[model samples]
Target: MEKTTKHPKQSFTVMNELVLPNDTNTLNNLMGGRLLHWMDIAAAISAQKHSNRIVVTASVDNVSFKQAIKLGDVITIEALVTRAFNTSMEVRLDVWAENIPSGTRHKSNEAFYTFVALDENGKTVPIPEIVPETAEEQELYDGALRRRQLRLVLGGKMQAKDANELRAIFYKD
Candidate 1:
């Protein structure tokens, strides 16, 4: 069967959660693990939307918690599939925290997650190609290759010298 092409906007996903007491640490800020869990789920949904198949998280890039989310604050997570390659796709997620009482909102952090689509039999499956519409989406689409190469090198799956895109940036000849 021929695979279809999907626009990045078509796979956009937004998730919101309330920072409850149980979700906070002793300092009353939302625990980093809890936030990571939320991000994983949101990114998975976006990947699934793009693939239309069972998606499993392949890897998560580093995530830095720059802002603290206090109890009762609303945490919003937005995810979009930036690029699709064969069976794997890269999802970008942006996190924001909002204080209802004070009517303030600020960026918490951003992260990249890689997901692979699977068939019902549990084997890897090819996903639809990503069609970036906006300029920002196009830019992200272009950068996804370099990011994936970096991750592969860092994970030891690929040698640093084999990362052509990344090598070009630092090792110009």
Candidate 2:
């Protein structure tokens, strides 16, 4: 059977949520854990869209909270599948905090999440390939492999020498 494919835009997901007092921390800003929860939900939606199967988060890459989202702020999270590798895929999420009074939005954070599709029996299942339309999408797609390799190496799943793209970063002359 021919493998299916989907465009990055086809998996694009945007989610917006209001930050309530319950979602705030002692400083009255949105809690980091709460934001991460929202990001995970948004990323899972994008992953499922691209794979058309049940997906679970495998890992979440560096998440730096650049700005504090205050209570009553609207947090908008945008996610897209950057690439798919067999059963696993990478989803990039962008978060923005919007102030209702000022009607302004600022980038709060960004991160990459990895998800794996599963069959009904919970076994890993192959997913469709991803097609990139724009230059930015293509760049991300091309770099996904390198990122995956690095993650595998860091997690002790793969040896450093086996990480081709990651090895090139340090061994390049």
Candidate 3:
């Protein structure tokens, strides 16, 4: 099979926010729910950019918090379209937190979100094809593919009714 070339679509702005006291728990760290909310927003933006229509989150996968964001930090959430299947697009989001004092930025969280393009009736709609232009774009596209497969495996395991079936799916090569 010929290697699939990467389609690097235009980057989309999902959403962003400044970390504040109210957005944090007692520990002054950003709340998980808040981060998830931003991630979803970012994913929706990417889906819209690809489809030029409204989109809805079908599912979110593998949200990992690698670091903590403290108060007085600016968080930037960006999403890029990495893959598409029919009406669904997989968006990879990276959340970076910049400390106000030090002006240093760190990747605090990352997640993969699946969105389905929607028409005026809120039904699934097709999205434009993505074309990756550079080596880095190809790498990002490959990463998204890996993440998509992982999502499918995890989702199968989560939805399996039988524990044995779940185990088999999880352990499959």
In model 2, what is the error at residue 37, expressed in angstroms? 0.5
Clashing pairs in 3: 6-132, 7-130, 7-131, 7-132, 8-131, 8-132, 14-42
The reply for model 2, stretches above 4 Å from the true place, is 1-10
lDDT of 3 by residue, 1-173 (tens): 01112234555564668888989999999999988987787678767777788988988986888998998899888777877767888887888999978979999888778888888988888877677777876876756655655666677843433344335556775
Q: Write the per-residue lDDT of candidate 2 for residues 1-173, one digit (tens) a residue.
A: 01223454548888889999999989999999999999999999889978889999999999998989999999889888999998999999999999999999999999999999999999999998888888999999988999999889889999988998887878976
Stronger candidate by lDDT (2 vs 3): 2
On the 0 to 100 scale, the lDDT of residue 60 in model 1 is: 96
Worst lDDT run of 10 residues, candidate 1, spans 1-10
Which 10-residue window of candidate 2 scores lowest in summed lDDT? 1-10
lDDT of 1 by residue, 1-173 (tens): 11223454558888899999999999999999999999999988889878889999999998988888899999999898999999999999999999999999999999999999999999999988978888999999999999999999999999998999998999869
Each candidate structure's TM-score, on Cα atoms with residue i matched to residue i, is 0.93, 0.93, 0.79
